[model samples]
Target chain A: MEKTINLTLKVWRQANATAKGAFESYEVKNISTDSSFLEMLDILNEQLINENKEPVAFDHDCREGICGMCSLYVNGRPHGPDDEVTTCQLHMRKFKDGETITIEPWRSAGFPVIKDLIVNRNAFDSIIAAGGYVSVGTGGVPDGNAMPIPKVDADEAMDAASCIGCGACVAACKNGSAMLFVSAKVSQLALLPQGKVEAARRAKNMVAKMDELGFGNCTNTGACEVECPKGVSIANIARLNREYLKAKCLD
Target chain B: MGTFFSSSIGKKFVMSLSGLFLVIFLLVHLSINALLLVPDGGEMFNNAAHFMALPLIKYGLQPVLFVGFIVHIFYATMLTSINNKARGSVKYAGGNNTKDVMWASKNMYVLGITVAAFMAVHLCDYWVPLQITGNVESTTLHGTEMHDTYALVNAAFSQCWRVALYVVGALGLSLHLTHGFWSAFQTLGASNSLWRKRWTVIGTIFAWVVGVSFSLIAILQHFFYQA
Candidate 1:
């Protein structure tokens, strides 16, 4: 027998932060358990469009769940109840029929609400802009493995580079903190020899840029890790601390 | 300050300094409170309280504690804000992401907010009342009224639910302070990677000892003294 489920969704809809926002309820029915959660949403949107209703707009790109684009808080959990899986990869089977799903965009002063189920995450870019890049251009002046990085450092750098910048850390944070995200970025560069030249400058500039963007402080709560699709370690935060201290002392 | 303040490294340095300061305060507080668990009862506890209440000590250390607490919270807020801002408009494709952090450390902000909320409660229960009333007054086991802070401490930690709440709150505090302690030292220039690793471990142990000692004393007193 084919299993079909019906669910209620109360999604946040706002033209922008300047505009008032409210939860609008919509019913999605006869959903296949095998269908991905986003597919279910696509079904709902299709229904709305057929009825000449404005569809709920959301941000997403690689439905494969590689891009950190699909940012949704389902029933108070970022990326829904599936542990470490983004909404795009979440199959409807994880949910039951007749369930109420509350969907909202990432909420943070830094990531402003852009529209219905969409938020502006440019604050991330600015932080990256602060010092995320190294001074490497088109033509490589050296071989790929020219700089011999230690195994441990290389491993740590790879781990840090795994950060997808999904903004889930911000959403899951009660204070809307971005410590996990920032730490990952810092750890990525701080561990590499190529990242050594401007290490001090990078840490200082990025941190300053983070504060200027209106994000909250890291209270040491681990909610970001729990909700993060990528399990970036809080240890990177410790590494970031060490880097910052060195930078400050040198300065 | 702004030049350093705005820098990522600068913020980490600030966070570490504040964290180290808090850790020192925790050790001192733990030692003092451990007196409450003494079988001699209120004599040792009251005397210690009295020493803390001395004019010079009270006026001087009290102000410093307040400043330390404020600076710790302020820097935490500033650091978190910067991380938030840097995330600006962008998204990622969800994939195989594994976290290296414990559940409690990542939620430090939430735990911190909880701790901060309780700080206000703690201050009101003891500090405000004592300051406003001019002094502590109550009956002791020996029928002496000598600055009986034991009574207030007893009343606060006795209620079943209140004790439970404190235990939970303390757990959060312990978890938070543990991570913050090592992380902070590393920020302030702890030797190299090897030394930093060792210190991180030491920091975690210290945090647990201090946190558990305070919470256990509260619970034990709630059982033994209250009865």
Candidate 2:
């Protein structure tokens, strides 16, 4: 067995919004292929901190793939070479020794770089803010199954709700469009009986907010689905379009 | 403006119409380019090229194609921007690890942008040079500078690397089309009880044929053509 393998990493280093950025190479020695991709980065950051160099700042909350915060574009692919996992879940086993991995932040006008590996995904919040929530007042004591939605609708709603809002769809998009995310959110709620009261308004507000955030349009490239961890259907986008059209034309 | 635009169906209707229009253009383009493979004497290719370049056709139809291109791009841009603003500051967890949605649809915008970028490159390679500079220094078919515009077509596609680029661009276009085609129809009211699954399959096949056919012509000509 080979005891040690060398790797070259070209990580993006931007001190702040005002500073120009460039790629800095670092050598990682003797890494086990079994190590998670983030674990490899942790090893690198530990080495940097020990050497008194400021560690590379990346956004990661849960080391598991559940949190969308661990955003990184590995070798021109959002979230490494693997098909559907987040950067945190990507294992080094997928890569060969001595491979040069190019790591960069999400490139989108809407997703501005906050620092190394951190992007302000506020664009997502605004879309939800636009109409993501149901308009029920507080202190509701309704039963869990008050309204009986169709089984198919319930199942589909569950599917749409599975979207974790990880900006992978945005990062993966060439035009930086967020239709997948917005549509998923809109469809999930709109599918439910509880969400009926404001379905039209919800679709309109969310879509408009999406447009305002500078994300590129969706031309159905499907790269988002190829990269989406949640497997959100492009059908949701169709649903979103339907909802938006209906809401728009009724007046 | 704000009132109706705020509805879900309204957006879907526009997106669907625009998408259908673009799909029609793709079919037309694919059929036209497929003429290059018609075989024997290059008669079909010339006729098709001449048909397209006729003074009436060029003058009368160029403006319409231009408008189609603009509307397709414009609505796509507008819808995307609105979604971004609406979903501000939240991200869904799951990476290549996410087990739910298909990766292709999630990254539609990315693929679209790639196709658009490559389209620009392709247009420059063929359309601009051939149309703007009519001196025709590239490839000449028999004696007359490949009049029938055959010279320009061969010139742009004959190179090995350029052929490779065309293949890659076609891949991007295919990826975009496969997901977008039926999806747009679905949004426009085709998501009925019977035709949804059928259209999805048809859309995928359509994407492959158009994309591969357009790209295959370039590759075959570069590798196997005897001229």
lDDT (tens digit, per residue) of candidate 2 on A33-145 = 87888889999999999999989999888978887788888876788788768888898888888988888887777888899888898889889988999886535667768
Expressed as tens digits, the lDDT of each residue in B8-80 for candidate 2 is 4455456667677877878887787777776654566766665676678777877777787677677667666
Off by over 4 Å in 1: A137-145, B5-19, B29-227
List runs of model 2 lying over 4 Å from the truth.
Answer: A1-4, A137-146, B1-183, B186-197, B203-227
**How much does each candidate deviate at the interface, measured as C-alpha RMSD after superposition?**
7.5, 7.5
Q: What is the TM-score of chain B alone in each candidate?
A: 0.88, 0.85
- Give the whole-model CA lDDT for all candidates, comma-separated: 0.76, 0.75
